[model samples]
Target: MVPASTSDPVPAPSPRPQQEDRDRSSRRRQRSAVILSAACWVSVVAAVVVFLGSGKPAQVTDVAGAITAAGIVTGLVGTDLLLLMLVLAARIPWVDRTFGPDVTMNLHRRLGKPAVYLILGHGALLTVGYSLRDGLSLWHQTLSIYSGGDMLLALLGSCLLVLVVVTSLVAVRRALAYEAWHAIHLVSYAAILVALPHQFSAGRVLAETSPQGVYWICLHIFAFGSIAWFRVAAPLFATDAHQLRVARVETLGPDVFSIHLSGRDLSRLHVRGGQYAIWRFWSRGTWWHAHPISFSAVPTDTGIRVTVRASGAGTRRLAGLRPGTRVSFAGPYGVFTAATRTAPRLAIVAGGIGITPVRALLEDRDLGPGETTVILRATDRSHAFLWDEVRALVRAQGGTVIEMLGGRAAGAPSWMSAAAAHGQATIHSLLPDLHASDLFVCGPAAWTRLVVHDARAAGLPDGRIHVENFTG
Candidate 1:
């Protein structure tokens, strides 16, 4: 059963829980993000410091030396950026908690091109420097570098890096299936492995005895170790701990269903309401694809539920899942939970299939009577996946549930329904206390943005608005 029900009204609280608790969690997340962001910048500055302290700048007496020094600095900064990318993509719980999964992955993607450019600059600068040093052509110098020491492996690593970056480009990425794209992305790990040996063998600056060398070695250890632990080992441990399997599947509407998962010690997953997990069902048709789906209901010790829409081939196969089909997941990720609350009241806006996480949020026990308001938008009654459950929960909590049904009205705010738009309804009109409440928006990307724009236009602080778009 869902955590909240119409049959059981929430017991009224005395003046609500102290607002300080909510403020404390918000401050903690902000502090954590600041500390983590500072550390990244410090690491980059230290890399440049290490390069400068090597006396390389003083040694740059000629054009060749200047180019060589430039190459080394670029290489150092580039490597630091690449490692930062890995750590962001590692899905470390602390990082995810601080930055949210969407922000973290977005940062990861943003760094890819610059990291590639810097690495390429390192190679190009080094090539020109060496060519000038030996009075050889760029081609001959390139051949010489490739033939010497660990340069061959470095060259191979560069090629792999290029491939990974190219495949990640939006145009290229969209052309390929997720499985194919993911397979190529995994090659980045191999690239890092192949690229690493060259650092010590080809450059003395990172020799084991130096302070710079020790710093870099530890950084590499931390970066790769985080990926191994959080991305690989942690998920494996969660899978083993829960041993999750499909207990049942209930059809909610056309193309929409809820997968009920049964597992051992499920509460150990520490899932927060409004968070999602990347699920991989161990079935012939669905095993190869992993989906990020929000929890439809909060978890108990033995069970959890995730709602899914058959929008693609991978998700369509979820309809055929049998009871006891093995399931493994890698989350409880995202920060769209009660812990993010920054205000005395909670306001939620969800559209179409986006209601899943909102359903889970409304079930949260901390939400007291008269402290929650939900606006669920859909084109029609059928499109409103779990509105009834949401309305029931809201009613029990002594809150409000507003339904917006119909397609968009022409020349109206894109996020609003025809009637609501025509009535001149806005976020402020619908949510009078928006400025004094934490607004959580979940829906299709464009529509979510429009809702967010309306909230912002209504003078809501950015920090007071939390969003989870359906698209990556």
Candidate 2:
């Protein structure tokens, strides 16, 4: 458990292997999703083409036939794609915990572009196919079938697509306030509702005339139902409407505060040590918005505790909160945990308020005698929140805490230099035998990158290093 010096410059963690693994996994999932989506669409299109090309004579009965055919195909494909998007969004939290939210957001943006394109194509095909068949204006054709209910649904669906496109655009989202954008985005559910019935009634392959129509209809209904429940209903119900109340607010330092929350009716929030929650202070005017904060304390009989530093607007608001303030927590999400990886030695690095999660990890009883070392970097020793608490906890756990004050420190400190020199010293001593140890970092992105880089350069495997981002 070698102690790192404040002055000892650590290299940036090598990103090659970690990045490669992440990229490879992302590619595999994307490929699988794309292939599945493509196959489903191709099958639907082939069925439509076959039905149209069959010996059955073309019937120009009304605009309904063309609209129905196009709607059927488009709805099938569009719905599946939407389902995939929901699944991806649900799984994204875990990915973000592993690779950082920036990476997850980038993937979300890329994947969404294709989904928007598919939706546009679906709309275009429906309009053109119906307009050509009726010899009427697009608007008139749409209105003509309004009495049948499908047209009304289609209009609503179109509106939803427009919302999705507008909100999804980076420029538009940036221009609009986050709250406004998020509110408009919530209309997505309404769009799904509007498009659903029309899809069921007008779909070709799922219609009564087709051989496997009944089966397909049942399958689609089941899939859509399940998706709706998992993606929306379950989450809403998971936490009771009664917002969490702040049981305690302890100021660990000048800008850092630890908020302890408890609610009589709140359900148990299952979460690992290194996870975070998006907390919304219900007393605030804008209760709809939530900000992510790492958990500084593990779950106990009382409730959950989150240690927050007043870095920005949301956090500042939180810092001002007094005891008994009502709040809503949206998650205990992220995959970073002590149980996920294995190593002979464990090194934890944290910067500023990022020590919250690291504190939780150190406090975990499950982590046995694995030669643990914690390095807390701050502008000054006084700026280190919970410094004494962390040191005490580490001492009790038989781990070591290396507090690096930001100013010029007396020749790098004898203990730090000794630890860096040997690498593999016991918790009491500073020395170098620490090579090949597992490293866990939670801090500002720059500090995390630096510590991780140094650890890797010192001969640590990619899998031996784990990092969690608190900023994003």
Candidate 3:
């Protein structure tokens, strides 16, 4: 009798707690948005009431004129703040290791452009209005005393707006580097802090005469304060107290290395396969700086393993590190997990060093069987990182590994035909019927774009193709 296969049947993927957390957070943001939007309309109505009630001509000195100006400026700024908060809450990391960085980053770009426009309007109107009211120069006018500390508060608000715009631009951001850009963006909290004083002190609607105005003001404070506490403070407090210490380090290839880190309560760490953590080596002496890296090894009884390929300054340092080094991690963040959808067949495609996340998925006992396929495309055979390990894992899982050696892999037409052939022995061949399958592709921006385009040309549905790019 044929020996019973020792390999366990592939387990069904489970729901990720992080996705649930994100859903909950999205609901809260929607509710907040509704309330804020209603309050904005209410403020508009109040401004109209103040304007119609006044019999005086619409001169700059008139109370109606001032009220109208203030209302427009406040509404613009408040709305922008609400939108930005909602975007930030969605938590799209440009180069997120999990969730195939491409999708998340595209959404971020779409939202960012509108936010910049709103911020510009808020700054321009307020500056001109103040300059006209006070007889001083534009800069000096913002400094002049107003009935309720509005001018001083406005000045501080302007400073924050300047910082946000400067750091958000791509050119300035690249020069500052990722670490520096993140640090500068943190000042957004300070901007919100300064704006609060101006809103409370100068807001005419918030005065005792308008009870509804006070309600709106209170709502803004509650929404902003809650976001700050949860997004910033909670993470700092909740991470493990005893940082991870590197137990072992091994260079697998020219640029690839496996780093094993162990710390207290390793089992309870609750990190998922295909997810990444932000690592900060203590030797760097900069706790604020951290780089996102994919977890390489399957979580074992001892510790966690992250595979790194030297790419930049921070990663180069990591590749050179010895064993027994201590490091701090901020997360097990990213939505790139097997739990997102269910399918009869799964295909994983990785280009260059993008194989890191795919490797983790291969190790998962939950994703094996004849239903899965792992495809890796590298520039050349010599540059094919993780070739041996990937091949072994694929065979063990009853899956196939497709390695396409670019540049010189025989004639183009023949090579393409061979790579697309179907059989048990020809692992590089593409599966013919791929309509109902799920495909996960991760790589540099250009490679991911090409793969996605080809997959679509091959009759793959848009929903079935998930592309993750690290560059964006």
Say which candidate scores most in lDDT: 1
Q: What are the per-residue Cα lDDT tens digits for candidate 3 across 72-152?
A: 544444544443454344343322332334443454444544545554565555556656655557676444543246656
Model 3 lowest lDDT segment of ten: 419-428
Q: How high is the lDDT of residue 181 in model 2?
A: 80
What C-alpha lDDT, on a 0 to 100 scale, does residue 283 get in candidate 3? 66
Q: Over the stretch 241-299, how does candidate 2's per-residue lDDT look in tens digits?
A: 54568887887777778888886533366567777777777666536567778888777
When sorted by TM-score, best at the front, the candidate numbers are 1, 3, 2
- Computed on alpha carbons, the lDDT of every model, listed in order, comes to 0.86, 0.61, 0.59
> Model 1 scores what on Cα lDDT?
0.86
lDDT of 3: 0.59
Model 2 accuracy (lDDT, Cα): 0.61
Model 3: how far is 188 from its true place, Å?
2.0
